[model samples]
Target: MAIVDEELPTTIFDFLPCFFQVIGIMVLVSWLNPWAFIPSGIATMCMLYIRYRFAHCSRDLKRLEGITRSPFYSYLTSTIHGLKVIRSCHAENICASEFFSHVDTNTRVEYLFLTTTRWAVIRFDWVTVFFVAIVTLLSIGLRVFGRQFSSADIALTLSYSLSLMGLLQWTIRQSVEIETKMTSVERILEYCSLGQETSVQRLPKYEPSINWPSHGRIVFDNVSISYFQDSPLVLRGISLNIEPG
Candidate 1:
């Protein structure tokens, strides 16, 4: 899933193929003169709108997550770097207030975006259910009044419509989630690219006596040390010997 988001084009691109497929299905169902076409189209449109909103919401969430993770460290480091000016100017409270304000903004944005998306999804789902009920009633009435459509035909149409609606909704929802998580994929890739610690090569172990010396002697014929990368050596050559006591 993560790889799909990372490798797949943006949310718009990711949704295009599915969107086209659903449109094709809707057209086919309409041509078939199914009793469920009207309700199914309505449901499909609602689901698509919800899906678009969800994609945007997901993007926001990914950004929020990124900010909350590494961005926090950057913020803190910057704040610390400016501590001297803040202290000197007696603006510690100002700095604190600014930091808190940014944090509050992030919190509000995240909470509101998630809440709105959830509520919208629930509302649209209810609307779809209502449409489904209406379609079922209409199918029943047509079957009774006209006697042109069979009970089985009506049932099949309704079932097919409902199933198509469900499939499209699920597909769009899954795609939105994947698009949103794409940001995390990018982050993970970036993290992986960071330098990794060199691993020690495995070697055969050598067993030693339990009564081995606790300390070892050091003998150096000459040693030198340097402090700076571009500077001359600090310590000159010297000989030293020391025995562990």
Candidate 2:
């Protein structure tokens, strides 16, 4: 167990204290550096606070963007359906203005949403840089002034400190990204959670047969359909009649 340069690979489990839930205790007692946690703890707390602060606002902004976009889509559908009417009325300029007006709200919110994410990234990076600086200063101070660490010890400290910074930044960035992306899932879940229409089985009092053109007349009246709830129907009371020879 104590040969120089030919020592057996250490396995603490076979030696002693290998019972029950004592694995973490072994790790801490063997390799834990108490000083390493300081900067990491600070960075983690700051990351959590920023994530929490942005959560509600980010969701609301995303929802607002959806609302604003609906108007533009409706306008596009309406314009396509009534192209001849629009051209006959000579309202291209007016229609274009209205479309842009509807789209303006969506553009503003989308811009702000992107900017907000960039702003958070900058802050997270700043926090990481500040932590690295603190670690560097402390390592040098302890080695030079305190004279408690050898050159090899200082090198090890610096290496670990730098490595941990990259890991910390990646963790923060990934956490924010996942949280932001989950908003889409939340929206889907919300839509799904809306009470579903119940089924009621009944015989139709007036079920029309598929036989066509027996009398050579077809008609429709007061029919409405909307893709989104609360949206205006794409076709409203569109009454029409067709005659066949």
Error of 1 at 109 (Å): 5.9
Candidate 1 to truth, TM: 0.50
Candidate 2 yields a Cα-based lDDT of 0.65
Worst 10 residues of 2 by lDDT: 1-10
Q: What are the runs in model 2 whose C-alpha is more than 4 Å off?
A: 1-33, 193-245
Residue 213, candidate 1: Cα error in Å is 34
Candidate 2 residue-wise lDDT, 86-162, digit = tens: 99999999999999998898899999888877777787778768877876687678777987667776666666556
> lDDT tens string, model 1, 1-245?
44454545555565677667767766766655465677776776777777777678678776675666455557678989988888999998887887777777677767876776686668666766876787788788887897767777676667656766655765676576667667777777778899986764435463545876556977777887676547899888978999886
Give every collision pair in model 1: none
Q: Which ten contiguous residues of candidate 1 have the minimum total lDDT?
A: 1-10
Model 1 residue 129 lDDT? 81
